[model samples]
Target: MTPDLVLYGYWRSSAAYRVRIALNLKGLAYESQPVHLVRDGGEQHGADYRALNPQELVPCLVDGGQVFTQSMAIIEYLDETRPTPPLLPADPAGRARVRALSQLVACDVHPLGNLRVLQHLVTQFHAEDAAKGVWSRHWIGEGFRALEAMLAGNVATGRFCHGDTPSMADACLAPQVYNAVRWKLPLDDFPTIQRIYAACQALEAFQQAAPEAQSDAPAAS
Candidate 1:
């Protein structure tokens, strides 16, 4: 049986964007099924999407008679299955460093500023747009500060997050930086992140995965 790799995701979603970068890095061709996040009160929470992923998260990868959720997990699965273009490091220590960097953005910063969390801050906590922007900027700054310190103060820093070539950390960093720009956060503090972002943006893969280049992204850009 031929394997099916359909990504059910929204274009502007950072998590989904990360998976898109990984797929492009691996040079895999798959079906893109856009799941609108906000229209009709969150279609991701609809019964149909929930049937595929109970967690109701975007970027669900349907491959080889199995379903995979979580952006990091799906990306790692792709790296494992298609090892020609490796996403991790050859050494265990290097792999750990890359994963740590990626998680600092994905697990720590992303959850705090995700759509649902931000919406809750607005609707439940009565946070206005300015307050929400402050909230997003605060967490992004915190994560980027630590990430900059790690990158600038360590020898692991290279042309990309792990090396001269793009890696998982670079994929994670680009999307987070994009979100920070969206919320109007100043990038002057994180020189290393900005430098890495510039390098990643020069690549066709990252450029094509950008929110502005996607079909589902808003016209605000």
Candidate 2:
């Protein structure tokens, strides 16, 4: 049975983009309920949204009357139910490798560089735009440099982060790459990551989830 899937997410959120990619990859249709994180003092903090997700984070997935937070958890639930367009690998080792790569971006890089964190640095710490950009580049460069080595030096790395097929790693990588571009980070150093990102962009799923293409995207500067 097809469940009622409503994704409460912000257009620019990488976490929300992950779930968007997963849904498209699985050929599942879902309602994209835009939750503006900045406008009107962050709609996510409002009583209505907080009722849905106490943590008040974007990319909240409501499936079959059950609300799920965390992009990875929501993607795993979709994978468990669908299983055709598998996000993880069939083998345990391969799955672990994929998850590791995914975490390299999601856990390590994203946490330090998300929108909320950037806002905090600027508002709370009185950081200027230049300082925020520096913060972004510092972490992205460190993370991408490490990822480039992993992808290029390791034999397991194929066309994608794992094997030839796109997996959870690709889902994670694409968003981080987008963030890198937004911050104007040099991609020349990480050729392998650039290559993988280009490959992922070729797919319709990634294109659809791109922040610029989202309904809530601000008019281009």
Candidate 3:
């Protein structure tokens, strides 16, 4: 069967990973259109893809002939259109909390460690891979410290980021945690985050959305 939805993304992009998790959680069928971010100076920069997303970023979703960019926006669109399994929450306060948590990672932390930012660090500032790793770890750790406090203190945080079911916050979190592990950041200080991440991983939605499980991911050694 042909899928009506198409997702253009790089396998390892955290932003793209968030969209993948959201799609899986919604039980939506989509075709993976891999855009190699590293090879050939990034296929995202190509004329065709840039037309779809002027920002030259991944996780561009095409649904019913309409194009959508930005991971968070796309997730919310899905939620609004589907609504069977809500990504936000029913109450206004809960919705705000989830969005705040999502942005804590997406806006505050993930941007510092983004591929383009790390590349600029190398080109403009002569940063080595070790320096980039350090940079990533520092920002991720700072964010996780705050995230841990928020999740730990909040009674709303249950098995997932909010209540028992996973929400947009969890969709945002799992990817950042993946980045933390990639940078070799220690998880000892974030027991709540670690626990929630473990819970997310046990779900089929997160399992299928993992970077390693993506079609564009390299073959296991």
Candidate 4:
């Protein structure tokens, strides 16, 4: 039987990781269609995928022939369609806070460290791997510094990014944490984030949605 939802994404893409977490949280079954971002210079650049998403970005969700782009938008759509186990808070203020937190990572942070941007650093500016690592760590650390403050100062924070339930913010957060670890950015400065990340990792949904667990990820030796 075919699931109503189909997700197009690469295994390690933070954007796609957010969507995958959302789907798992909602307990929605979906077919995973792997888009190899680096193989043969990116399958996303091919004609068919570009037709589906002109932006040629991963984490494009196709539902009943309607295609949705952007990780945040896709997660919100899922929340709207499947109200149980809601991703956003009920109150307007809470929703705003969650959105703000989510955007802090998805918008302000992730873009600087995105694959294309890193590739462009090499192809355009001749940045070596060490230079690229420095660039990524700098931006990720900058973002994490702000994120740590926000989460630590806010009373709304709980076991998760929001009132103990795994909200959209956590979905956005987990991937950024993964990126931070991948870039070898020291996480000791952000205790709140570390705590929340530990909480998130304990969840089955997050575990299932992890990059290493994705079908397209290379098998361990």
Q: What is the TM-score of each candidate against the true structure?
A: 0.96, 0.96, 0.99, 0.99
- Candidate 2 vs candidate 3: the lDDT winner is 3
RMSD of 2: 1.5
lDDT of 2 by residue, 1-221 (tens): 54489999888999999889888888888888999999898999999999999989898999888999988888889889889889898999888888888888889998898888999998899999999999999999999999999899988888889878888889899999998999999999999999999999999998998888888888882
lDDT of each: 0.90, 0.90, 0.96, 0.96
Query: Residue 45 in candidate 2 has what lDDT?
Result: 95
TM-score of 3: 0.99
Tens digits of per-residue lDDT for model 1, 1-221: 33378888898899999999988888787778889999999989999999999988797999966999999999899999898689999999999999999999999998899999989997899999999999999999999999999999888789989888899999899999999999999999889999999999999889878878777777886
In model 1, how many backbone clashes occur? Answer: 0
Q: List the residue pairs that clash in candidate 4.
A: none
Poorest stretch of ten by lDDT in candidate 1: 1-10
Candidate 1 residue 143 C-alpha distance from true site, Å: 0.3
Q: What's the TM for model 1?
A: 0.96
Pairs in steric clash, model 1:
none
* Candidate 2 backbone clash number: 0
Residue-by-residue lDDT tens digits, candidate 4, 85-203? 99999999999999999999999999999999999999999999999999999999999999999999999999999989999999999999999999999999999999999999999
Sort by lDDT, best first.
3, 4, 1, 2
lDDT accuracy of residue 40 in candidate 3: 92
